[model samples]
Target: MIFSEEILKWYRENKRQLPWRDTRDPYKVWISEIILQQTRVAQGMPYYQRFVAQYPTVSDMARAREEEVLKLWQGLGYYSRARNMHATAKTVVSKLNGKFPETYEGLLKLKGIGDYTASAIASFCFDELQPVVDGNVYRLLSRYFGIDLAINSTAGIKQFKELAKKVMSTTNIRDYNQGIMEFGAIQCAPRKPYCLHCPLNKSCVALATNRIAELPVKLKKSKVKLKHFNYLVVVDANGQTILEQRKGKGIWQNLYQFPLLETKEEMAAISLGQLKDLGLGDHPSILLYNERPMVHKLSHQHLYTKFWILRTDKVVAKAIPWEKLPDFPVPVLIADFIKRFKF
Candidate 1:
């Protein structure tokens, strides 16, 4: 309730010296916000610098190839973000005439910009008095106010937005928003928060009532379903590995991957005939080189993957362009697998 001056002062003194904070450019802010989503500051920092340095403007990003964009975003998970970012960049370049949409509503209309991102761009760049309610803000607000509402719920989101807007400093919205967010990240952490040293300890409802963890209430997340996949990493004598761009609408749709055989669970063994059944090639004399099950965890899916690195004496007649393995963009997990196996 009474969270204004103290938080702002603390933030002014303790905010992390991030590169993104140095600029008030909406496009740059948008880039940083998107990169920071589902990513840690430590990891996302370098990516931000690389991306900004490469594509200085929205037009630059738009002009870049999808494969090139994905290559830059290689190690970062959530390939969809990269795809959407490209699409949005093109939208800004073509539709908006190379000018970033200044209004929150206009920004929200972009391919990937959501409420939180739009708000961040608006406040940080445009100096609009809109509150940015990210995960950190949500946690801090939920704990400080002792809100019992499930943070994921529509009602909770509405309430938090209203509260955040109320406390947002009208004169210095950018600093205020950044302050609260930094405070939550550094002090009011999700697990084992440093409450003893926190400036808000005296006024914090969670600290006073010993309910810090419990206060940031959230709906029980849906259990991540386990999916079993057997990736056939078939390579020829020239050391070129078989890779295909995923078609249709699903995870990593445009990203490249090896021939995959999906089952309910991990299979004891897979035959060469199975690879042929998937329309890979005929007369497949596949010699299994490596067969280790790698468990890859996604946001909602747990992939129990069995990678079968098979070597072939010669290229299959039906195989398409195996020499261009490095041309296509792939998910980080697949990319990592390739790099490690030297495929």
Candidate 2:
């Protein structure tokens, strides 16, 4: 009770005035929670606001095209989250009549709603006694309890979840959960925490032991796989370009991009012979956009990409005017190119 009281006091005085705060609307909470996952508040705020304005309700989102949703979500990466959110919106509109599930278990069954998100919505909007254990919670609990377990490890996850459940306040369930997470964000930060003035400093185990830097351990990630991507930027004489949609599963599914020619390994440069069958004639001009391949890093793989600009008089069958490029959804890598590359 004392710990919870201290956290709530600090929270009431120091919590940021975010748009999603003080709202019991489940849709708003759901959207905000999803955007904040693996994204910083400052980086995600504009997108959250845009999303709320664009799709004010589940029915609005369900009626929107997936391409439109992806375009709005461009540059934020982790496109799978947007896809799942769209699918869930359609599900809610069709099956649940635009109403979100009220219980943590029920929310968990929805697409893209994991334990953290479910707990967040369940407690914040539904007044359920579910606790959230996100990165902030994990860090704060690890240091305060002086636990040195690797947070990514299975045993560590279980131990911390059990601890969170035990410590979560029952009297002020929503406020307590929100306060603890807010405390972790501002006071018990990952680096350079304000331990000297922290509300829990007197009883914090890591501070007492002088091991704040090492308490929250995390195992090293596996080596990132390397991929060689060759993109063909085909522009006809009429200042039009060709694009193809990414089909099936895997990275960037259902997104638009220039015709790609993936290779097993990186190549120095591509010649006209390489574009032999890709609607290129003998006299077409081929130039490498970058002298060296651009390294675009994703969570699992590093894309060593090279965009080959091919201009020819050959009339492409499905070429679209370059002015219409912004209408289609593209990856951040391609979006950056479009910003710099002038026709």
Candidate 3:
């Protein structure tokens, strides 16, 4: 059976009833694509809806503050996406005169948009014959074709993308694109894929050869680097705590966090006065009360974090929006700290 036919048949019966799928609006499609990157559908859907509802147009998003955008994207991790979305919105409004670029190449020029995003926007919105190659699509194609190349490698990505484009039906690019993606997301899931019910099972090379898992190969990731962070939660008698915004191009840039001191490794000794070594301790009052250590994992880093609660009489100078900490939105990691420490 032809690849497009199998996908089309499966999509008609199993495609998700997504709002973005029902329309050809470039703006909505772009928003969905970006939010869905490194994010599950169940997780990305609410953020997509809220973003579309809050900022209907690129100009509206462009004019919004980064804090406001990040606030709306509080729970959703990979904050870089929110920042990129905000930056791209401003670019679209300013560079394209409030109009989303209409072609694949034009869309690719936008900040944060890559080949996959460009293809999705182009095919979905303009019916352009461009193919999207996300992890789902990669897995499906590799399994069906029995390709052995590492899917995450630079060369592997190029090869798979070429193969995907070759199989993409030009007659109805929009439906074809949506059909393949839907087929991958549902029928050809990464684990325990329903090979028996799959429309392409007859022609799937990986299934016939008993190499389903081995075919969709990926390069092993480097070991996660362990880093330690000591957060200071200094509170005045008014129940308000000092919060700081991370700066200078490291992880969590521009995001609000507690006063932090990063050490080479986890510190065995826990003391209030030790903060002076990290450029603290000058405050008039420093009463260390409680300490909690959390291990937060990211894709490339494992964060071993410890928070110290200290009582102070005044706010520190480096704190972010100190008077308006209540107004600023915080990530769950920070929110949990506030709830437990009680200022």
Candidate 4:
């Protein structure tokens, strides 16, 4: 198809020579793809280099402690991806004998390897001839072909996947997939794409019909949940404090944070009386570290957080000393708090 032809030709001269693109190894491709899932190229590049440098191979990651993995991935939000990637690495080393599955379907058996990731690894490394479809691909296909379906809807997703497969290049599938995605990322961008210079501009239905801004439709996002967190910075004369690992199946699972007391609404005033929720029976003293609550916004939740300093002569068990605070991987919110905090 002319669409496929033009995209590949454009990709040949215009594609950025990213570090991951230089290597034929699936390891780099896998890591880079996962990192870029939620992060832009420039921001994710350093992280990719650091992470791979730390754990150079699947065995290296599988054998390393989970805390170490979380530590390297500390600043990157969406901690679950790190956890899942770690788990998948262990599985890959143990069950698959330290080699990644070659086929698209085989890669999906590994944790966190969904359609997009599997397709990426399969096509880029193994030449499986599958297309990787993410938001960029969705925007590209939606604009060039003038698909107005909501990219998030079930029907829209199915149609887009089929269309991506239909339009993918059969001979040079690696460059073909890369070209389309690069084209989408750089040329057919979400905001103010350079339509005049776009190679696909003449054939793009959205450009032709003046629908570039509205072509890739999406449904409204779910209401952002507002949550309040009161972190107790308990100390007992010694420069030591308590840190608890988050338990459960969520983004910050296995990560550490201070003693957290969650309330339905923002507390009018955090009192020493509120120490009971933290299982502390009437702490001797309390002080609000930050007079104003800091708001940390996530994809679907907004956390209004406040820190309270609790002073007590009584010893608290399992308290990590001030010097050891950096050892554990806490959420970015907590990490930021630590940096600004004196102790």
Candidate 5:
């Protein structure tokens, strides 16, 4: 109980005044939790504000189009999260009568709601006795208890979950969960934690053992594969540009982008002849070509992208006015090209 008491004490004095913490609204909590996954608070805060402003409620999000949701989540990178959140919103509205699931088990049934998110929503919104074990919790608990197990391993996950449940306050589970997560985020940080001033310094096993840097181990990530993309920005004399929706299960799914020609590697040589081979009609004029390819790195893939501006007399289907390009949702890579080219 002392561990919970100390963490709550520290939280009361040091917790950041985040927007999501101000309300017990399940919808807002769900949005904030999803946005903050694999994202830092400072970076995700604006997106949360924008999402809440645009879609004030779960029903509002459910009624909105996927294109509109993807447009708002343009730079957030994880396109699947946007798609899943949209699907879950619709489910909540259609099936649950717009009321978010009140229990951890019920929340886990929703799309994109994992154990951590479900536990967060259930406990924070409904005050359920569920402990959240996110990255922050893993770090704080692993270090404080000096557990050497790899946090990603099955044994470590089970052990940490049990420990988290044990330490969580029954009467104040919401603040206890928030306190420990916040404690890890600020005080017991991944790097250069404030051990000297920590309230639980005397009891912290890692601090006592001088192993603060080594307690929370993680498995090494798999190698990132490289992909080369050649995007053709096709435009006709009428200033209409063609955009296509990505149809497959891959990065940027359901988002709009320029005509893409993926090659085994960076094209050995790009020319009009190669353009014809890529299915573009013959005699397409190359107005501009970025000789220098831009590199965009994702978690598991590194993309080498080159954008070429092509002019063709032949009519192209799905062509929209160039001035109205912003009306559609495109990947950040394509968006950057548009901004740079002022298209």
Candidate 6:
């Protein structure tokens, strides 16, 4: 199709020189695709480089500790992706004999490998005829062809996948897939796209119908629930602070944070009296109090956090030397607090 040919031509002349695109290694491609799922290219590039350097092979990642893997992925949100990626690597080594699945269906069987990721790895690494249907592809196809179905809907996803397959090049699968994604990212961007000089402007239905902003319709996101976090930065006379690893299947799982006290609403004051109520101890002095709460927003949760420094003369249990705080992996909010307070 002309659409495919034009996009491929544009990609050849204008695509970014990404490290992942330089190799046909399925492992590297898989890593890049996973990192870039909810992350921008610029943001995910360094993480991709770090993963490639730390775990040069799937066996390397399989042998590494989950804590070490989570540490490397500290600032990157969506910790589950890292955990799943680690699990998938182990599966590749133990179950698949250190080799990634060669087919789209086989790749999808691995942990965290969805249709889009499977298609990307299969086409880019194995030159398989699988079309990737990510947000970029959805936007490109919807706008260019004037498809109005919600990209998040069940029917919309199926329709887009079928259309993507139809337009995808059978022989030049890699370039065609890359071209469509890149074109959507840089050319037909969501905001203020350069439509005047677009290669497919003449054939774009959205442009012709004066509905460039309306073509790629998406369902409204659900309301983000608000939560209050009261972090007890407990410190002893020897400059030791207590940090607990987050457990359970919630946000920031497996990451370190201060002893937390979650409340339905913001606490007016976390005083010495409150410490006794919380069963931590009695008569501890409030060393540092952040009157202003820091607002940390996640995809589905809005955390209103306040850090209270509780100082005591006696040694507190589970306390680590303050200087060694950087050794552990923490969520971005905690990491930023440490950086700002020079902890």
Query: How many pairs collide in each candidate, listed in order?
Result: 0, 0, 0, 0, 0, 0
Q: Tens digits of per-residue lDDT for model 1 on 29-132?
A: 88998899878899999999999999998889999999899888877878788989999999988889888888899899998789999888988999887899
Per-residue lDDT of candidate 5, residues 220-239 (tens digit): 98999999998888877566
Candidate number with the higher lDDT (3 or 4): 4
Error of 6 at 294 (Å): 1.1
Model 2, 276-340: lDDT tens per residue? Answer: 47665677887889878999999999999998888999887788898999999999888888788
Cα TM-score of candidate 5: 0.95
Note the residue pairs that clash in candidate 5: none
Q: Write the per-residue lDDT of candidate 6 for residues 171-239, one digit (tens) a residue.
A: 699999998999999999988889999999999999999999896999999999999998988777677
Indicate whether candidate 2 or candidate 4 has the larger lDDT: 2
Tell me the whole-model lDDT of each prediction, alpha carbons only.
0.83, 0.89, 0.81, 0.88, 0.89, 0.89
Compute each candidate's TM-score over C-alphas. 0.92, 0.96, 0.92, 0.96, 0.95, 0.96
Give lDDT: candidate 5, residue 310. Answer: 85
Better of 3 and 6 by lDDT: 6
Report the CA-based lDDT of candidate 2 relative to the real structure: 0.89
lDDT of 3 by residue, 206-298 (tens): 999999877689899899999988777766545555676777987777788877878997766656566653334456454444344588878
Of candidate 3, the 10-residue stretch with the lowest lDDT total is 284-293
Which residue runs does candidate 5 get wrong by more than 4 Å? Answer: 271-281
What CA RMSD would you report for each candidate? 2.3, 1.5, 2.5, 1.7, 1.8, 1.6
Model 4 vs. true fold: TM: 0.96
- Residue 146 error for model 1, in Å? 1.0
Stretches of candidate 2 off by over 4 Å are none
lDDT of 5: 0.89
Predicted candidate 4 versus true structure: per-residue lDDT over 1-343, tens digit per residue:
4888998999998999899998778878999888888789998899999988998998999999999999988888777788889999899899999999999999998888899999999999998989889889999999989989899999999999999999888999999998898999999889999999888777889999999999799999999989999998877656678898999876598999998989998776667666754444564577888878899999899999999888777766767788899999999899999889985
